[model samples]
Target: MSGWTAHLPVLPVVLPLIAGAAIVLIDDGKRPLRALLAVLATLAQLGVALWLAGIAGGLLHSPWGSEIGVYAAGNWAAPFGIVLVVDRLSALLLVLTAALGLMTLLYSLARWDRAGVNFLPLFQFLLMGLNGAFLTGDLFNLFVFFEVLLAASYGLLLHGSGAARVRAGLHYIAVNLVASLLFLLGAALIYGVTGTLNLADIARKLPALTGADRSLFDIGAVLLGIVFLVKAAAWPLNFWLTPAYSSAAAPVAGVFALMTKVGVYALLRMGTLFEPGGRPPLFGGDWLFYGGLATIATGAAGMLAAQQLGRLAGHAVIVSSGTLLAAIGLLGNQYTPSMLLYLCSSVLATGAFFMLIEMVERNRSYGADLLAVSFEAFGLADPDDPTGPDDVVGIAIPAAMAFLGLSFVMCALLITGLPPLSGFVAKFGLIAAALEGAAGLTPVGSWVLIAALLLSGLAGLIALTRNGIRVFWSNARSTPRLQVAEAGPVAALLLLCVALAALAGPAMDYLQGTAATLHAPERYINAVLQAEGVGR
Candidate 1:
């Protein structure tokens, strides 16, 4: 690669940071100006990500081998200074972040209060953090990126501070703070053991540590896993998600689609470095799989309990969380690429769907109580309910509700691992890989995965259908009032969903390549070191 391309890793993350800072200084009354700036930054990030993704495909597939892209600041060497590495996985995740960021920005264009100070800057900072997380090749840098993103999310999540939102935000902050501390402790322990913070260097060095220190390393790995698991909202630790996500403004939550997946990405990246022997019996083995299955079961049950669109969407996210972690937990080299691809596709679908639900709710002035009534009646409630929370659906029977309930059913099925959609393709690939690896006990384990997946899918579908019936198809006489401009973002998002389904074949191929590259990270390590002339 040329020196010009060597700098590619930093541009995707930096563009957003600069743009976001610029937005902060701009006049708040300038709505058109803010939108223009946001759109430009988003587009630039998207362009960089696409270029990097293309470059990664060529590099990884090259017979000569691949190396991580390392950009030295002011010509500084890696260990003595900061470095960013872009490989197939990082590049792909950057692209996914850009896609989701752009979609959410579009959704927020008209949805956010133009005069609000926190809206634009906070989101820009959030993207900066996300881009940083994906590109940085250093462990400490990854933590910095995590904090940057989490801090921005802290502000974004509590933007309105409505009573319910405040309640939710408290829980969100508490869990994340604990997670952040764990991340720091893990990093500190790893740094203490290895004496270096560069991930590539650590990967090369980790294999050399055996004995009590190895056990210490194992503890650090488990701690790091705990931090990410919390972030990913896995089972037993995901209790805070429902109220927090459901109460946030729709567009805000839409942006958050990228947030949860960061944990999954971290786990995948770290897993590659530590558990490359495939599934080590310790931290990488059956524990993660069982925990993931438990998460799936809990999320499915929650989906059944949720009565509103926003809440249902929140629960759906948890279900996706289970699928992602479980896919990773049931790993093989072949499945890794598919899992990465599936996450990218799932984030798009879930984010788009989330934006749509928010728009529909705002247009209809629907509330939680109205949602409950509609669910019970199996019909759409009136949009003009002046009584606020007490509004009831007029008279649609269960049959009418069943018709509009199709969307929820599709969503449930999509997240729970049914076919035709990308979710099924992803889950199928993961399960097949697991079965292939299950020599002694894997058959029973694989069967358990399949059963949990099916049961969760059914439960989510039932819950989603129940809510959709009450909201969209109910005999409720709510006045209709959605302007085209209001729905434009969601319409654009839905188009992305179709695009994913249509482009599934090529996407899966890319994922396969990415997985192969991740499994044998020689290219990733060599790229960064070779850039530094350490091995050359």
Candidate 2:
């Protein structure tokens, strides 16, 4: 833990930061080099992240019985300087972010990256911000990283230029800008009362507050919680998600799948940090539970009502968010292991779905989607229609339609939590864990979640089946032009999910250890505070 790999914890952030800046200075015309640099940086991040995950896991089970790696930025210690801590949860997310980013970048090389200047740079910067967000141990730095993330995302969202993308990008920016203000206000308020922004220090300081200080802190925490919910795309604040994600180019939308989880990660981390002070979670109790239920209901309803493939995938993101939030909100029964497994499963499936939708959408005509939508409101020669591109050279040999059909089926099964896939395994784990709980949560609470999850899955099944039939079977159309770059990433993402299923037992074991550590956070606090500063 003390050798060269001590730097592993920080490499995820530094690699991307350096690569993004370097790429910016290069000529935009140097596409190959710029792309190569970006891909190398992301692959490096994936390597570092996996190594750190191994270290964290091994350390957790070693005689040392700890899984924390704290890298004091600028060699400065906690409470006084920036810190990056890699534990089970952060390391897990770090790996997830890098893997997903690599896939998105690969998909973009098919041409989305060429649609605009600085695409690779913005992509790298986005990765930097996401990695930094997962690694940072302080709220102020989290805000900085969040801003960096949003700035880059704004560019990525509007990368291809259409009225739909522009409109969605505007709304997306507006929402996050407001969320950012709330974030700063909340962080400032917490710092004012706690005299510290470092997570470990805040956890240590939260106890022993009197009346007004506690009241103000509580208000700030709620403000912060609202911001997180927005990022998580919870309920009323989530309207922007469907539009923004559905409107963005394929690769951009694929990467955006991980963005919502940032909010969930913050909530889980902070809940652990703050709970030991004998305080209820900022968003706990029946209200949180019911709010999550409403979110699930809304998401399922959207899925059922979706006309376009992009919107369906977007709604699927909402469903995943709702499930995780509801599990977290189940006051006494926290299904941590199951939730973590579900997190990995859902993110992979949704990201792949986003990318796949673009290719599937490409093969058919606009009227096809419009008529599909006409089930509520709303053409092979229609392919010659100017709006519906006819010039796309279809992939020869083993026909692109065959690939699309297989991929679409895989996505549908995964998103719907059907059997023999990681999604089914994850959903089963959730229900089983809830049932096996100590009965701390009320019966009503447990049953509500179980029902929502099952019903939501049902809704997903119906919607996806309808869409699949409409898109693949109902019409005769030219198959999409596929590239190895585009197809490879989607296939890889799905295979990871398949791997999760095949290795469910081991995956759950790891998650169980992670959950146990999360429930017991004293080690996390002590490790960060005791970490040495430079010249110490």
Candidate 3:
């Protein structure tokens, strides 16, 4: 790596940092200037991410080892200096976080940014944290980046300063603070046992551990996984996720769809880091499969039971997490590109859905759900609802409602894993891969996971269908005023999903390559530990 390309990995972190400070320097009254600085900074970050992904994706197929760029800050070597790595997984997620960040930022400009002071600064800082989290190559920097993002999130979630936001933000903070503590404890244990913090260095050392050290290492690894699961909103540990996420400002909630993935990324990244020398994934074959199934079931049931659009989207996030975790359990080292494809598709759709939820309900009357329920229970035709919420879906929607209606339906399709979208393609791929049955996963386990997926999808369909009918068909609705900034971001996200479906073949090839690289840790360990740093 040379020229500007070698430095591409650092820009994702630096761009946001500079933009945030620049935004802070601007007067609060100069909203447009602040907005311009923020947007330009985010756009630049996105461009860098895409460039890095292109380079890393290309490197995935290279005959040589796959390290697109490994930045050794302060001209130091591994285990001593700060390192940022751009590889298949990190690059893929950098692109994801940046794209999602841009959309949510655009949506925020429509109104959410003005809700509080320093909103723009906090938002940019959040981006910096997310990018840093994805790009950092070791547990120490991972914790640092996690704190940076969590600090920013604490501010962002309370942007609107409402009662719900306040309560939810407090809960969110408490839970994450505990997770952070667990992070430290886990890292300390692992470091004590393994004698290293750099991921690559740790991987090289793991195979050398013996007896009680190995046992302690396993315990530390499990603790670390628990922290990730809590962040990923895996059931039992995920109680704080829904209320906090749903109560946030719409744009905050939209961008937050990436937060859960941060957890999944850590799990996926470190799970194999401990399984040195082609041993089956240390954590993948363990409790992750059953835990994932439970999470999916819980999230699906929550979605069915939710009346609020925001909470439904939150639960849908959980369902997506469950699906991915289950796959990680069953497909570790087997390398299913389909799983990666599903991940990208689901995150895009979920972000779009969260953003759209606020828009759909922007003009909704309070107590609408209760009133509809009342009418349905008594079989009375309420004047407010020409077609009651429970009425069969056969209403002719006015032209004014077309965009919202169509977008809502698209969201429904994406969430429900229905036909003619990336959701169906991704989910179908997952089902097919499961049926094939891999090394550690039994045929019965594969079939059980398949059933869970199908059942979750069915639950989502019923819930989202009921939601759509309630929002568009049953209640009389007038179009809410929408800005180009607001609609464009949501449209772009959904369009990306459509593009994924349209270009499934090539996308799967790239993702499969990613999965294959992930299973092979030798390449990662060598690239990181043997990199030629500055002044070499």
- Model 3 C-alpha lDDT per residue in residues 462-508, reported as the tens digit of each score: 99989888888764665654666677799899999899999999888
Model 1 agreement with the true structure over 271-387: per-residue lDDT tens digits: 776654232232345777788888888888888887777777888888888877877776566567667756866686677667667644543545441234323343333445555
Write down the TM-score for model 1. Answer: 0.87
Q: What TM-score does candidate 3 reach? A: 0.91
Tens-digit lDDT track for model 2 on 212-325? 998888888889989999999889789999999998878999999999999989888888778787443445556556777888999999999999888999999999998888
lDDT of 1 at 356: 62
For model 2 the local lDDT of residue 51 reads 81
Q: Candidate 3: where is the Cα deviation over 4 Å?
A: 59-67, 277-282, 333-335, 365-400
For each candidate, give its TM-score against the true structure: 0.87, 0.92, 0.91
* Candidate whose lDDT is highest: 2
Where does candidate 1 have its weakest 10-residue lDDT segment? 388-397
Off by over 4 Å in 1: 1-3, 59-67, 276-283, 363-413, 434-441, 477-479, 533-536
Please identify model 2 stretches exceeding 4 Å from their true place: 59-66, 331-334, 365-397, 437-440, 534-536
Give per-residue lDDT, candidate 2, residue 501.
96
Worst 10 residues of 2 by lDDT: 371-380
